[model samples]
Target: MEIIQTCDEMAMACRVAARPLGLVPTMGALHAGHLSLTTQARCDNAILAVSIFVNPTQFGASEDFSSYPRSMERDLALLEEQGADLVFAPPPEEVYPAGFDTWIEPGAVAEGQEGEVRPGHFRGVATVVAKLFTIVRPDRAYFGQKDGQQVAVIRRMARDLNLGVDVVTMPTVREPDGLALSSRNAYLKPHERQAAPVIYRALCAAEQLWRSGEQDAGALRSAALAVLRSELLVESVDYVRVVDAETMVGVDAIGEQAAMVAVAARVGGVRLIDNVVLV
Candidate 1:
């Protein structure tokens, strides 16, 4: 795999590379979940480009920006093994630069839940993603459904801004015990790692309620919240809701639409988000 580190080089690489390119954008520390996206992208398009930038703009003042995981040597090895054709692993200054001032104002889709807690988080996310879309110019971009709100925000950004890239999302990869794979999983202690699967179980509790003819959104929220609260390791519950999978807006009933039973909580002080789509 050719590792291009600068924007100009990446643009030039895109210029001569094959058509129908596929992009898998990531903040490196490649796990099974990330490899899953890369593997699928390789099969779907003629050229596969994976970006490994841990965007600093996405992290808030108190967030783990300085300490977010970085394993470039291993990440490159994994990408090469997964058959990735190109990788754009840029430095922070290369992406934001000294005078970088412009930002994307992600609208309603980013107004609640994770948005409420992590203010300006999606703005950083939207802006960096827009930069990637502009630089890579992929025919299709892949994201994991684990980031439900993120996918919704990016989809809206691409459509409203006419970015002209198909934002394809794949099912979230999970462990055999159901904990969603995440780079932040590295921060969890042994006990915290063991307790983290409760997030998925909470989503499943809400799913079970949906499957058992519980249509009231409040009740669904309550069901998931109950399971979450039962876990003593759960330090805090940020938000648990039955929201429209597309718009990230809260829903009153299941009806004919798909809803995301999403949860964000601090388990052993390691914040984790997970969801299950109830159709």
Candidate 2:
């Protein structure tokens, strides 16, 4: 696999590649969830590339940016095994430069949910992802539905800006016990890890209600929150929202269209997010 560290090098490499290139952008610290994207990229395109930069812009002041896992050697090994052709692991300076003033403001779809909590988080995400999209110039880009709102934001940005890259979203991959796979899962203490699956269980409970003809969005949110509240290790429930899948806006009732039940809570000191979509 070709390992690229600079924007010019990455752009040059991509320019010479075969048609229909696929890009999978990621922060370092590879997990099965991330590898899933690479797997699909390999299947869909003649040339596949992955980026592994832990974008500093995306994290809040008190967020775990400094402590976020970084294992470039291990990440490269995994990508190579996954059949990736290129790895663009650019340094922060190469991405942001000395005075990086421009930012992509992703408006409404980003205003609620994670955005409300993280503040400027999606701006950072949008900026870095737009940069990656430009640098890689792929025919399609892959993202996991694990970050559902993020998928929504990026899709919106692509459409609005005419970025021309097809945004393909794969399903969220989870652990055997149902905990959604995440890089932050590394921070979970043993006991917190044990309790973390509660988020999935709670989302499942809401899905069950939807399947059972429970149309009231408030009821679904309450049912999920009750499950989290009952968990002894759960520090707080950030949100348990039943939102329209496309717009990322909360719904009052389930209609013919799909809706998503998403939950974010602090289990131990680690914050984990998970969701299930109901049609």
Candidate 3:
């Protein structure tokens, strides 16, 4: 696989490649969830390129930017095995130079949940993604449904800005026991790792209730919260909401519209988020 580091080199590589290129942007530390996106890209496009830049703009001052995992050697090996044609692992200076001042502002869709907590997180995400879209100029970009709100924000940004690339989303990949795969899963201790699956279990409980004709959004949220709170290892519940899938806004009732039950909580001092869509 060709590894391009600089923006100019990446652009040149894309220019020389075949048509209908597919892009999978990531922040190193390859996992099953990331590979799922790459697999889709490989099947659908003539050239599949993946970016592994852990963007600094997205992390809050207190967030784990410095401690965020980086495994370039392993990541490249995995991407090569996954049939990825190119990997763009740019340095921070290359992505954001000293004079960089521009940023993308994601509106209402980014104002709550992860956005409210992380603050300016989606703006950084949108900006960096827009930069990648500009740099790669791919026909389509793949993102995982594990980050549902992020998918919503990117889709909105693409449509609003006329970015012209198709934003494709794949289902969230989970562990055998149902814990959503995440880079931060590395932070979990043995006991915490065992406790982490509770997030998914709680979401599943709420989804079962939804399927059983529980239409009240409040009821669904409460049911999910109850399950999360019951877990002894859970430190806190950030939120458990039934939200409209498209707008990322909380809905009063499921009705005929698509909605999702999402949960964010602290387990063993490490925050984990999970969700299940109610179709």
Candidate 4:
């Protein structure tokens, strides 16, 4: 697979492709969830491109961007094994250059959930993703539902900006115990790793409550919080919210359409987020 580092070169490479291109944008700690996105893109498009840049702009002042996982060799191996046509692994310098002043704003859809915890986080995400979308110009782009708010933000961005790319969101991949796969999972200590499953467990509890005719949003959030508190490793409950999957505005009751039951907590200094959809 060709590994291009500059935005110009990456754009040129895509410009010459004869087939419909697919792009899987990631921060590069390749896991089964990431591979699933690439697999889906490969199946749907004639060519697949994976971008493995850990975007610095998306990280907050005290965030882990400086120490975020970086395994270019392993990531490349995984993408190559999955038949990725190209891998764009750009450094911050290459993508940002000097004095870069552009940013993409997703407006209010980014004001809650993950957005609330990591201020300006989604702004950075929206900006970098907009840049990647411009460079790759893919017919289809893939994202994991592991980032529900991200999916919602990108969906809104694409529609608002008329980017004309098909954004496909795959289900979150999890371990047998239910923790969603994440690049940050590498930061969890042994005991913290064990306690991390409560995030998913909490979401599951909320899902069960919704299924058992407990449609009250406040009751659902309370039930989920109770389950999450079981994990002593969790430093704090960042949030447990139910919202319209599209608008992201909190709802008083669950409806026929989908809603996000999301949670966030710090486990041994590593923050984890997970969600279950209420159908």
Return the number of clashes found in candidate 4: 0
Error of 4 at 51 (Å): 0.1
TM-score, cand. 3 vs. native:
0.99
Which pairs clash (backbone N, Cα, C closer than 3 Å) in model 4? none
What is the C-alpha lDDT profile of model 3 across 1-279, one tens digit per residue? Answer: 999999999999998999899999999998999999999999999999999999999999999999998999999999999999989999999999999999999999998899998999999999999999999999999998889999999999999999999999899999999999999999999999999999998998888898898899998888888888899999998888789898999899998888988888999989988888999
Runs with alpha carbons beyond 4 Å of true place in candidate 2:
none
Model 2 root mean square deviation, Cα atoms = 0.7
lDDT of 1 by residue, 1-279 (tens): 899999999999997889899999999999999989999999999999999999988899999989999999999999999999999999999999999999999999999888999999999999999999999899999999999999999999999999999999999999999999999999999998888999998888888888889999999899889899999999999999789999999999998988898899999889999999997
Higher-lDDT candidate of 2 and 4: 2
TM-scores, all candidates, are 0.99, 0.99, 0.99, 0.98
Q: Report how far residue 241 has shifted in candidate 1, in Å.
A: 1.3
Q: Count the backbone clashes (under 3 Å) in each candidate.
A: 0, 0, 0, 0
lDDT per model, in order?
A: 0.94, 0.93, 0.93, 0.90
lDDT of 2 by residue, 136-202 (tens): 9999999998899999999999999999999999999999999999999999999999999999999
The superposed Cα distance between candidate 4 and the true structure at residue 255, in angstroms, equals 1.4
lDDT string for model 4 (49-141, tens) is 999999999888888888999998999998889999989998899989899998897788999998888899999999999999999998999
For model 1, give the 10-residue run with minimal summed lDDT.
201-210
